[model samples]
Target: MTTKSSLNAAPRRFALINDRIITAPKEVVPVSVLRALASIAADQVLVRDHGSPNDMVLDDRATVDLNDGNVFYTRARCDATPPAACGSPAKLAFAVDDTFELSTAAELPFEAFMALFGLEAGKQLFRDFESPNDQPVAPGSVLRFKDGPVFYTRGGQHHDARVEITIDGVKHKVAPGKTSGADLKKIGNVPLADELIQNIGGKLTPLADDATLCIAGGEEFVSHPRCGASS
Candidate 1:
């Protein structure tokens, strides 16, 4: 009986990004060998075999990083097995020397700017007016009050009455006129929307002439992205 040689006895190199595989060198090489080499180099790798002009298969295979900070990804495809419908040809293009950067928590915006990432404050305050229910404000719930500058009360005493209230460490000021508690509640819950106005040193405009309300944060908000991408 005749014996068949291993298809991937020798490997080739290639580069990949943006879902497109770089063409291999002019010299013919075994596809399996190229995949094996790539798998060895990256923590995660993908291969696409374009054995035919029209057919492609994206083989999702990758290596995992245990202690290393790098992320690897790969895909593969083959052309000879089915209808000729693949998008491109398989070829070695170039070598990818990637430098991975670690993402730190410091990159996230402060609580005052949480609105940019769609996060809301856990606790908020309404100035001047009293809540209909005589209950301590709950976390993660909106608090409403009547419009006008809020009079800060300390030790059962009314302090300086100002439109601005410092929540946690973030400062939110009310508009000059009256606003309903409902309107203030909506503004506090929208971190991005409010922060945008606050950052510009602008006032939160009243929804209606009869509206009067304000909101303040309890603590600074912070966010961090678990990971990011780069070439």
Candidate 2:
């Protein structure tokens, strides 16, 4: 029965529950609804697994906080299979600018994906972008099953085959995405004994030889001689 007090309660909230999503009704969620939303049975257990230190059981809880992303998992009450019986890790295959798709099993967030690939805000991920009616993928979305799924991206940021950077006032075009300081040095033909530095906001920042960098256009780099004044 709908009551005036319940209607006047706080707004409803959404949370990720065991590969599925659920919403709280007036800040208080019933267990039945939670299971229904998660496609789990009543006998299943909702666990908050973190580490060996402490793992809380969430089945007894009625309300979960929002504002911060809420994540929960559901497991069988009794497990006959061994720990090693778990299924294979999920794999997500994605590509940008109609490039070949690459698979990843890591639970990497969308922001990290953008940074690693030098993707900009305009770059958007979608399902079946080749089709007439394509669907847009929400940021931070995940595919949890062990089966590998593919997605596509389209945007101007991914259209560029190479990024143009200036090294010691010399312009060079290099592949976009993750790069190492050694690769930049090689591209600039800097002496092996010299150190590589990046120029940003008029400040010179040192770059490690093996350091991974997200290549972008118009980036300025300088090579400094390693030898210092002899005392």
Candidate 3:
């Protein structure tokens, strides 16, 4: 079983790409070649498709099925809704058996294409690449350092309380107000928590509301006892 402490210690990062394969040395390969390599099952592979405005293609994937002969892919698709369609891009995910291969139609080198797979993972990958300082926390988020990174939920809607911090150096998601207290305790060392709570209350606080603190882009509201309603 993978322990939280051990998992947090591992290194991972995120890289952005249009349609390419990212290699161990952090090189970008064409998407076609990446698809071919994935067909053969490469180790520790990540694939992503940063959609272009005119292309209308969606692809964002991450996978680690090398030795066993499995390929995984993810797609992040843009929604047709007004804001989502205009602002957000489309995404998708895919997984295939090792027997798969890049079709002859592809034009890029396999190595170059593989680089695109790791974009989302690249963010965490960058964290893993950099020396461990404080774990990356959103500006207005409160982070409680226990045996690992523990996120606490301020009172709101009742949701899953147990939260697990990823020690693998990979980024894990913890819903803003949905994580459980039991989850926070599992991280241990609850007393040593730190808060980046913003003064503004509510999910969408205007930047002018709190001059004392600046909010990060796309920050959701998280309520804390000491910080009140923060991002």
Candidate 4:
């Protein structure tokens, strides 16, 4: 006769982030969430197969599979140039749901840029205005118009696609592609995104009620309704 297995099964191993090992029944978890679990900071955290070269750096979309031995290791990464340099290409890429996306490349076609914003190719897209320096993007490009600036319409108002940055207690709006050390200087004197994170004493995961939340797409700050104590 056949027998049924017990319902209380053991949790499966997911993947290792840094020295910590994560095990869960779920098949996948966002890299950002995993970094938080391992106490590692954002953007620079590199996840790779347990033992592999730097070329295998896993993006935010990497998944941990229990059946395939998808073990991983996480470490902070750095670029050789100083944060104050200008015209540097974005070094990382990430997606924000189906509404928006970002990628790291020296230069991409206008079609490629539109695709990131969920725009259809070969369509009569309505741009707010013609950019002055509109041209093919080059390697090591920043948010300059030569790299094909993106525009969007909201409530019949035109706007450029940009991100948020906080410097010395002041928040500023900046382009998402401009998170590099050089790109950040357009608004104010600020350290590299990674540098700021390191200076803040690594990833902030405290049991206190005044913890900070660092969201993806640069240093933007947003309020989470559930994060605060209710009245």
- Quote each prediction's TM-score: 0.17, 0.32, 0.19, 0.27
lDDT of 4 by residue, 102-191 (tens): 344534454555565664433332221222111222222232222122333322123334445564456765334313333333234443
1 or 2, greater by TM-score: 2
**Clash count per candidate:** 37, 0, 56, 1
Find the candidate with the highest TM-score and give its number: 2
Question: Any runs in candidate 1 off by more than 4 Å, and if so which?
Answer: 1-26, 40-55, 58-83, 87-231
By summed lDDT, the worst window of 10 consecutive residues in model 2 runs over 1-10
- How do the residues 106-170 of candidate 1 rate in per-residue lDDT, one tens digit apiece? 12222322232233453232222233111112223321111111111212123222345433235
lDDT of each: 0.29, 0.53, 0.27, 0.37
**Model 2 Cα RMSD, Å?**
17.7
Residue 187 lDDT, candidate 4, scale 0-100: 37
Candidate 4 regions with alpha-carbon error over 4 angstroms: 1-5, 8-10, 79-231
Q: Compared to the true structure, candidate 3 yields what TM-score?
A: 0.19
Total backbone clashes of candidate 1, pairs 3 or more residues apart or in separate chains? 37
| Model 2 residue 227 lDDT score | 84
lDDT by residue (tens digit), candidate 2, 142-178:
5321111233465554453445899989987655567
